[model samples]
Target: MKATHQPPTTGDTTPADLLRGAALYIERHGWNQGAFFQLPTRHRLAPACAMGALRIAATGTTDSIILDDVFTQVLAAQAILANHLEPDYDHTTDLEADLNFEVISDWNDDGDRTAAEVVTALRDAADTWDRLHPTGGENA
Candidate 1:
């Protein structure tokens, strides 16, 4: 008989899970995720507070991620990292120290694997970062 040691489950914070979370947000809000979130666009993901949602709709922004109205920028940051480990940054000079984060990077050719694998890797990375930076998501 072969001795099989199963890898411990991350218990749900994987990137695949995070991407599903993004979908959930869309479903919950009854908005089309494809229409709002453009894969190739480099738009900033600013979470909409209850009041912020009003402003987001009022302003003409084409490419933006519309998440739950309650999530804050802090949560969005964590979510984006967890869902897509290698995410878009407004600029290249951003540093972990400045954001009080430890640098973690994941690279994959877009067609090399399934989206699930990519998302799971990112989820693991973001979870690791969150463990280090435990100051976020309380109210976000």
Candidate 2:
């Protein structure tokens, strides 16, 4: 089957949507965004973008997200689309391009929303979920 590519900005407007989309993309690409020690310039492990997130989670630097864990990164990404997180996406890679799609930005444009903003938004949404006790009901 031909893999699906979601339209630009189709569902990823909110913070939750943005996070889920990013997480989904990372998961699909089999990327583990975490800290890696670049031996040539190593003081400690350095964080890589998506893999950095993973490394940080594995270590004690930051709290982890449900997305991209050893057992459930894939499912958590799907669940982020299905429930809890908002917006959602289909972040499949295209081998012809031989890279994950980059979220385009316009330097001439004026908006608070940048690629960094998108990542932040997603992380915030994930943090919010982490704050919530899933076992408790709505009042909790």
Best candidate according to TM-score: 2
lDDT of 2 by residue, 62-103 (tens): 234333332133233223322322234433222211111122
Model 2 scores a TM of: 0.31
Q: Can you tell me which runs of candidate 1 are displaced by over 4 Å?
A: 1-20, 23-109, 137-140
For candidate 1, lDDT tens digit of each residue in 87-131?
555212323323312222222333344434534554454465466
Global lDDT of model 2: 0.32
Give the total clashing residue pairs for model 2: 11
Best by lDDT: 1
Q: Tell me, what's the RMSD of every candidate?
A: 14.3, 13.9
